[model samples]
Target: MPHVEKAVKDWQQQFAGLKTSAANLMQIAFPPLEIMQSPTGCCETRLHWQDQDSEASGYVCIDDFVQATLQFENVPHSVAGQALDEVFGLGWFNGAELGVRQAGEGVYYWTDETNAAEWEVSVLPGGLANLSIEYTNAPDIATLLDALHTAYEDPHEDDAAT
Candidate 1:
């Protein structure tokens, strides 16, 4: 287990920028997503919510800031793929499926220009394996915003510039 905070502050901090970025990039307008605490030791310490429209949603279950289990959905395969990077700090390469370089036996990875983050993957036979890399260490992010910025050139576009 890496580490993950059982809090929603991260989402709160990025929601506005995420919303704007999604709008600019995806061209699909969605109101703010109110990430709600899904209080549970009974289930999992997590935060959950649905995006304002599109039934698309994401949830982060960070029992103790040790690590997180994240998931989101959208109609498009590409858009859905983008979520792992945008909604979660995990997509360093932004386009790994386009191509991935072998890192080791049965393993491949994609890295951002700064090497700040990477999507370490185990392309197991039929995609079944348990190779894990701590994707939560990312912050300045090709891992953070690339998915949301997939369509926009200026991924780091300041909200004030809008």
Candidate 2:
């Protein structure tokens, strides 16, 4: 797909501007099975996870728009396997320690020791050619510190009881 290639090239250009090298940009081949059917068309893309100067930071580039949904046509078991393989191949999550959970209908969560991120991929309920991704940034160091203080504080005053 030309669009898919263009998307990958665009990402590479952006990365180059940041003085970063995207060592790996693999193409996810279409699945052999049909799990969900998309009347229009379906395409797959790849993402990379890199360490930013020893900090735990990463970016996920969806071939389509950041707010696009993921759909399959007559999605089969093989497709699901391929999809999981593609996601994990990016090394977005650590091999063993990372947690991947499905929080809701089309929503998934990825969390490691230092960071957490959520992804929602699904087809538009009806037959619409659109997708979406809603991402919420994990709490920063300051936010976590404030939460720790609140956790240790007592909710009641002992003087009143005395």
**Top lDDT: which candidate number?**
1
How well does each candidate superpose onto the true structure, as a TM-score?
0.34, 0.22
Q: 81-139, model 1: which lDDT tens digit per residue? A: 33333443333443443332211124444554443334444433321222223324323
Clashing pairs for predicted structure model 1, backbone only: 2-66, 3-65, 3-66, 3-67, 4-65, 4-66, 4-67, 5-65
lDDT (C-alpha, whole model) for all candidates: 0.36, 0.27
Q: Which runs of model 1 end up more than 4 angstroms from their true locations? A: 1-33, 41-45, 81-135, 138-142, 149-162
Weakest ten-residue segment in model 1 by summed lDDT: 153-162
Q: For candidate 2, lDDT tens digit of each residue in 81-116?
A: 233333443334333122211111233333433323
